[model samples]
Target: MKNIIINFSVMIALLASCSPATEKKVDKKADSTEVKVNAIPAPSPENNTVLKSYIPVDLSTLVPIDVLNTKSTDVYEKYGIEFSGNCYSCDLASLSITKDTMIWTNVCDENDTFKIDDFSYSTEGSKTIVKTSERTYIITQIDKAPIYELVVEGKKLELNNKRVSRYFTTKKALSLFKEHDCGDFEG
Candidate 1:
């Protein structure tokens, strides 16, 4: 009989020590918000189907930017875009140059136009200078790669342009040149 009582007491104690996973309490005051969570949120769907690559290109695959940017030359290149969560049509960019005229096109739209015909360009060290009637385009390249910067009237233009084509070198510098003015990735 004593053993049964002791066991009963122990059982009661063990039950008391356990805690409920969730508890409910009512707020006496009106307009009170109480939120209690017990489990993690369900997984959401994946949005971006695109993936990115960081591996550098083979040097043997690259051509000089001066050659690609030359007026008599026609250049076309594509860039594997970095998958930065959300991706629009601008995920990939295409650039083409014909007779001192450059056009930037993506999967979504027609193209953006840039005129080198109105401007005379000179290669100085790591920079390309295009002289326009109203603006002087100072294009600085990075690491001999095709990544270029077009600073016109002394302003850094944003060309969400893809990486350089030298890495591929045409697409990048050209895209950078395209975006140097305005318009979003899709724009």
Candidate 2:
């Protein structure tokens, strides 16, 4: 009976040592020994790099204008314009102009036709002449640096430098407009 008791005690001690609580502690210690890795930051551009690129314009602050009427202050309200090229990709395009400034936005992309909206062009030195919906004129004395932004699938991507031109290709531009049935403006 003494031997039996001794054996039972040993078994009980072994079982206790192997309990779930003890196993969990061992697991926690193992987890703590694991190393966590973080992502590295992207490298900055070289100091000598030159950047020149067109950015999409913001149009919320300006009023729309008829590209045809140079004298009227009447704002032109339309859905948007489509512009597609190897250089730009967007879904919609719009133009809004005030006395001195213009704002624009690109809304969608079909094949290559990227939509632009809220686009503004300076009418200060430019003369607006009545033209068809497809043909309108805003002759600027000096081409200004226009700001532009791109939205793709609800994700906004900005093209800040001309060096990024390599990312856009003619094939992609044609695909954008071709998908939308917009005439091949690139040709």
- In model 1, the runs with Cα more than 4 Å from the true position are 1-86, 89-99, 104-107, 110-116, 154-169, 172-187
Task: For candidate 2, write residues 1-187 as lDDT tens digits.
Answer: 9999999999999899789788999888777655221222222232112211121222222211112333543222111122342224433333333333333333232232223343333222222221222433333212121112221222333422211111111222223222323345543
Clashes of each: 5, 44
Candidate 2 wrongly placed segments (more than 4 Å): 20-22, 25-187
Residue 156's lDDT in candidate 2: 38
Q: For each candidate, give its TM-score against the true structure.
A: 0.32, 0.21
Q: Tens-digit lDDT track for model 1 on 31-135?
A: 143222212232221211111111122211222232223343223322223333114434333344333543334423445323235544455456555555665
Q: Give the top-scoring candidate (lDDT).
A: 1
**Window of ten residues with lowest summed lDDT in model 2:** 162-171
In Å, residue 8's CA in model 1 sits off its true spot by: 99
All candidates: CA RMSD (Å): 19.7, 19.1
